[model samples]
Target: MKQYDKKMIVKKSNELIDAGFELSLNESRLILYCVAQILPKQPIKPDEMYFVDAKNFSELFHLDIAGVYKTLKNAMHKLGDRWATVIDKNGDPKEIRWIISRQYFENQGVLGIQFHPEMLPYVSALKKHFTQYDIKFISRMKSSYGIPIYELLTKRRDLKEQTFTIDVLKRKLKLEGRYSAWRDFKRYVIEPAMNDLNNEFGEFDATYKTVKEGRAIVAVTFHYKPRNKSIPLFDKQGNPSSEAPQKRWEEYGYRSAFEFREALELSETHEFDLTDAKEFLKARGKPANK
Candidate 1:
């Protein structure tokens, strides 16, 4: 678990990013921490246990040790109860748990998670068309909506634009009823989240403009532009997110970048990003190309 930067990376397919799920800041922190722990290029499995150690959570997120035990103990149950609604390959809306099981040892402050088999394609072995960001960027962000908004825009960085219908955005953020007024949504949700993204990100500027109809705000478009700073191919955590890899392959061994199909369960064809081959090569104990 001890890697560079002491940072946690949350990499997920764009589908999961746009899926309808609402998690509080604590819940987001707990799940994201576990997702980042997935060893690089090692595909996730439904039965594989992913754990969130309260001590690890405390150190990474700058939370008090005592408080993390209590906070995460509570968030553990709530997160287990959460399920995401996503559109399936047949264009059907399906409700699926990103996590299929949650277990915690009494008084240990360690919570274990099992990724729903349905989510392996989205959260693991990502090489392309996925959103990769260090959770530390929003670790301390107080806005409940900031993390989701950050992801919605982060995934579209290649296109530099993401537009969402007002209704659709709300459902994705799980903000349908709250922030009932345009100003409230803008001031509380949009603006604050934009600030969080801008502050944590480097070599990028985040901006937004509202689309209105006869004084009614109907949609919102987020824009990203590169800044002058030069970034590296990988982060302090050794996460190679700066480089644009090819689109992800739908099935393992169904494509060339990954040869260990037997290592993962076969998934549906409607998938996409295969991250760099270095980690996969490294896992096989082969000398990766420079």
Candidate 2:
């Protein structure tokens, strides 16, 4: 069986992060991992049915075959029973379930999931206002808070800075009563999550500061960007490496690699090797480029 070299997920952060739904750590990781495999390659079709082989789940999640089936079985049930809230015409929140229908072919190692038709607007095309990240970025992430924080940061990837009020942050993280004390939340949740994201999660490095209003901590502000190490100065061919080009494509919201290449072709300086151009652009960003 072929294994994925790299997996990617593209989702509108609002739906995944702001839906106010809860899932077990295992379920959350599994669902997002599965979604990465099933999402359309390009020109997303709203009515399309997405399928994932159980083997793919097992391999991706590093679980045994039987474990994959059992976990997915339970995960699907939870997903079916849960609801996501969306604002209705009256400006009130309305709840909708995610699973329109599902089928598990245990014998064939395949599972088919059809999302509710209503979710297409949030998950389809997603030409704008979407977050795209590679699964490798979170492969080592384990804490429940890790993925959500990662999503929150990635949503503002182009921004130089973003802040979340302490209360609002807890609300978004669904830890309303779990960590009543700011000290406990910071000691147990915030610190560890930040460490995991910076050290284990791929390329991006995030650092945050807590803001205080008088004696109380009011907000948390994060400064995030791709790691300087991940952006290689040059490849062996003396060409700009993939990292910078990929980052530019991501920042510009190019959905597909082909589109990014095509855009480069249409530029007036198309004849120049993009590698040199990329290096030149980087030089412009700094006082000096060694």
Candidate 3:
């Protein structure tokens, strides 16, 4: 019943973006609307919500399963260390549930009903982009029945934040090359290509940093920011920009050598048997016969 504030929604949306969750303009707007209505004192039961169903939520915006999944995933990742609930088919707690944080709830209030804080941003964005008729229908649902359809969803526990060590050269090429291969690869191949692409599409400044664990390269850091808003070079439309491959490659280049070594070690631990010899033989080709 309460009116939502635009500034509050924008503020929360920006916060989520800075935290590595990229949301669309429309999504940012809608999430703010929902967060504005959530009661701070009461934790809404996940099962008692209606808009949790991917199908139902998708209908609100005429989106497909993949779209719904992606939106929810991005939102969940943004909530980071938030609290939420998981329910089973019978609308009962599944023992495992999402536990959202008070800060997240306080920042992004709930809209139509109690929802996982992660869900709020996507749903809000959907509302923002849909047709007036669709918005009205959703708004009516919020005002009347509310979204009490959370049973079909499973809320997973937030894993403890573990620092991921990236091993770029070893992971990709499997070469026992020097750590400099990564830097050289990025400098010659990745950075140049990225710069060219950005120039063609629009320029985004690329920066890299290194992380080391003792003597090894642990991970490399690649940070990118658009040189300006006028150059819109995001390859994927609607999806979050952070998940793009170019961005990932750029980031991999910045990781430390120790990360690459750790990745190699991990790969060795999970070594799998290769039963298909045909492909292997084909790879060796005529040289093996000679």
* lDDT leader: 1
Per-residue accuracy of model 1 over 26-46 as CA lDDT, tens digit each? 888877887787744565556
Residue 95 in candidate 1 has what lDDT? 85
lDDT of 2 by residue, 1-290 (tens): 34545435444535555655556656666567655644422444556667767776666655567677777777787778766665565877767777677788888877777778776666654433455566667666767777778778765555647898877777666567887778898987798778768864455777899899998888888887766322222222323234445355555555544444433422212223344445334433444211
Clash total of candidate 2: 0
Residue 177's lDDT within candidate 2 is 80
Rank candidates, TM-score, best first: 1, 2, 3
Task: List TM-score per model, in order.
Answer: 0.73, 0.70, 0.22
Prediction RMSDs, each to the true structure: 8.6, 8.6, 24.0
Give the per-residue lDDT digits (tens) of candidate 3, residues 256-288: 323322222222112211122333333332331
Considering lDDT, where higher is better, how would the candidates rank from best to worst? 1, 2, 3
Assess the local accuracy of residue 125 in candidate 1 as a C-alpha lDDT between 0 and 100.
67
Candidate 1 lands at a TM-score of 0.73
Best by TM-score: 1
The residue ranges of model 1 lying beyond 4 angstroms of the native Cα positions read 1-4, 106-108, 200-204, 226-290
